[model samples]
Target: MIVITTPTGQIGQQVLERIVDSGKSVRVIARDPSRLPQRVRDRVEVFQGSHDDMDVVSKAFAGAESVLWLVPPNPQSGNSTEYYLNFTRPACQAIQSLGVKRVVGVSSLGRGFGRNAGILTAAFEMDALIESTGVSYRSLRMPYFMENMFHDLESIKSHGTFYMPTAGDQVLPLCATRDIASTAAALLLDESWSGQDSVPVVSPDSLTPNEMAHVLSEVLERPIRFQQVSIAEYKATLSRFGSEAWVKDYMDMVIAQNEGIYDDDLQKVQPSDTSFRTWCEEVFKPAVLAP
Candidate 1:
């Protein structure tokens, strides 16, 4: 049996679908089983609880040979590092106790870069803690998600502008969650690999916000402009929706990305065939036009 955490999320849902299609016995951890799509819930066993709960996680791991682990984002935690560590500590212990042989963890691109990536520090810590479990693990070190662009969509549609802290000329690595999910599913199904390893899953082509805007404009048939915001302004904007600590970390990440601190070597893996333009035309465009 293969078990998955956070199965209701975008990547989690996709991975679950792929696993179901593969005809494997599957289990998922969810806080609310009713929230899962009925069709998916029908095909898999559901263990309802948070990842932070050791007893629940332990019970769910019974009879499972492999696991897909994901650390759900918690921007509101009083102590983010402690929260992640606390959640992973028990899960790791449970995985070790259950004798699960393989694990696929969802991690970010800046995981090993220390504090240079700000809020992503917790993710780095989580990766370290999970690796310490000594399971044959693959950490999917993912690039910035193309879905993040959705955060600016409403503003862009209303004001015709997309704002960012990075220079419009600078290109940064970006990947779709679907591609990441697909890769994770493939790893979960293949149990031949051993030892701890990190895989950088990134799009072959990196595009600037300006280039992305151009692509969106071509698809939407409306002019969309890219606007660079100062770090101060960016922080101020984020502060309205998040705590000062969280906003500071977020702004620091933008600064890091702008300075090319989180840039990764793309030669290790071939990019997916999905382009930003294709994503906009096929995914974003339809969503925007949806009634």
Candidate 2:
């Protein structure tokens, strides 16, 4: 049996669907099983609990051969590292105890760089804790998620302006969550490769914020301008939205992006065959037009 953590999330849902469609015995961990879709809940066994609970995680890992692990973001924690470690420690211990043969973990691209990458530092620490479990593990080091860009869809629809802290001309790596989910599912299903592999799942194309704006403009059939905001301005803007911790983390991530810290020398794994323009047309445009 294969076990999945946070199986109701954007990427997790896709992973769970792929696994279930393959006729595999699947188990999913969630704090509330009722939150899962009726289709998924019917196909897989649901373990109702959080990752931080050792007894719950241990029970979920029982009889599972492979696991897909994800560390959910904790914005309310006083220390992000501690919050991640709290989840990782128990999961790792459980994995060891249960003798799960393979694990595919979702981690960020810049984790290896440590504190030089700001909040990603916490992700790096989680990677360390998980790897120490001595299981055959593959860490999916993903680039900037295209899903993250959805945050600005409302602002773009309202004002025809997309704002970012990135330099308007800097081409940075970006990947769709669908691609990450597919790649992660493949890794979890295969069980061929072994210990401590960091895989970079990046898009084949890289684009600047201005270029992305042009694509959005074309997709929406309207004029859209890219407005690059200073770090301070970005922080102030996020603060106004009542997300102080997110503001700090996002500002730091922007700085890391500007410094090219997220630029890893690893080969990329391309999946989904979805381009930025296609994503804008199919996903973003539809969402903007909805309601």
Best-matching candidate per lDDT: 1
Off-target runs (Cα >4 Å) in candidate 2 are 240-247, 266-272
The 10-residue segment with the lowest total lDDT in model 1? 260-269
User: How do the residues 28-99 of candidate 2 rate in per-residue lDDT, one tens digit apiece?
Assistant: 999888888898899898888897799988999998889998887655554566667887898888999889
Q: How far off is model 1, as Cα RMSD? A: 1.7
The TM-score, computed over Cα atoms with residue i paired to residue i, of candidate 1 is 0.94
TM for every model, in the order presented, reads 0.94, 0.93
lDDT score of model 1?
Answer: 0.81
C-alpha lDDT of candidate 2 relative to the true structure: 0.81
Q: Write the per-residue lDDT of candidate 1 for residues 43-141, one digit (tens) a residue.
A: 999998987798898998888888898878765654556667888887899988999889998877765454556656666788889888898989888
Runs of candidate 1 exceeding 4 Å displacement: 112-115
Going through the candidates in order, what is the number of backbone clashes in each?
Answer: 0, 0
